[model samples]
Target: MSVRYAIYFAPAKDTPWWDFGAHWLGRDEHDNTALPQPLLDEVSPTELASITQAPQRYGFHATLKAPFRLAAGTDEPGLITGLRTLAQTLKPVALGPMRVATLGNFVALIPHTASADLQALADACVTGLDHFRAPLLAADLQRRRIEQLDERETELLSLYGYPYVLERFRLHLSLSGPVDEAVAQGVTQAVSAHIDRLNTEAPLLLDRLCLFVERNPGTPFQRIIDLRLQA
Candidate 1:
């Protein structure tokens, strides 16, 4: 029974980011209902749909703890307790302002400036619950292509079980996967409008953390638990 779970920042239900992300990616987090994708003239429906297929499964979130199986002897209740304990000690982080940014082949929202609190939150999630993380299997290592990692990244992978963390972590709500570089700017422009809509209301805050579960390989990750920061 191989299962994977992640600690993540999932926007509150009914918030602009949540609604827009769910509909844009065509997967509603609340009920896993299939929704319509954003209609954009710059990117044809076919192309947009194809690019979003990857992100849609995971729904909309910024990874705090990348997905991993529970370590031997650890149980679900223990993981939840660990998450709640961490949540109580942190404060909600205000995302000053964000814009569509390119990360490798994908496009997503990135903050104008990084927040120290956010960094601490992510680092805590990576390290605090680390004891609950099972060691990465050979197949998992191959999926990340450990051979291509730089020395420091390889070290991070070995130490933290994920390559992008600490100084390398960039909080992003992924919108697509492996898009064409030629149309990247246009794609960003298209999504920028949606992000603009998010600005019309209160600035988005990282007020709550969510637990996402993948019951098995190829299954859609579902947002199963939400914990509010006591502060």
Candidate 2:
């Protein structure tokens, strides 16, 4: 019923991960670009397809603000302006060196150290733009598995519309969806190898804010804008 939008931190276009992940997931979120999967050694396209299918729709990125409907009176243009204003005030930092790690059944790239700057940025994104977010529907609450959450988490979910935030938020660039331990291990090795080859020394400044929109239900989110953070 309501249009959904999310605030996400995606790799910048020139970053190796940007195009590398795009081809791996076979979807370019910026322009909804699609490409055939590359020939991965020891990993077949079919296997890669199955493991990545879940995260593929969203493309490759970390969720800063989980998707939500715009608050009743809010409009897209206003939200965009509000986001730009917020970005301007937040300090930027590079992601630094990251390595592949397995969180549950998914493989992702996590920074060697938790950067306070990154945490502050994520916290601001969640709390700052919250007023523009419509309350979650009952079904949405159920989907979050509220019964399994602790008291504090339930409260955050009620106030913030998502449980993973504040203390719970883990900033990781996901590379695969759910898979068995063996498969996850394999994916982790594969991702690590790719990152190792990249050998990026400089950290990506976490200044740019991207607005991703779900134009319709069951549709892939597209990057509508890259709002720069100006001093």
Question: Which candidate achieves the best lDDT against the true structure?
Answer: 1
- Cα error, residue 153 of model 2, in Å, equals 1.7
* lDDT on C-alpha atoms for all candidate structures: 0.86, 0.82
TM-score of each: 0.96, 0.94
Candidate 2 regions exceeding 4 Å error are 199-202
lDDT of 1 by residue, 1-231 (tens): 489998889888877788888887988865778898877888888988888899988989999889898999998899999999999988899885778889988888888889899899889889888999999998889988899999989998988889999877889999888877867787887878767767666588899889999988988998889999886
Candidate 2, run of 10 with poorest lDDT: 198-207
TM-score of 1: 0.96
* Regions of model 1 farther than 4 Å from truth: none
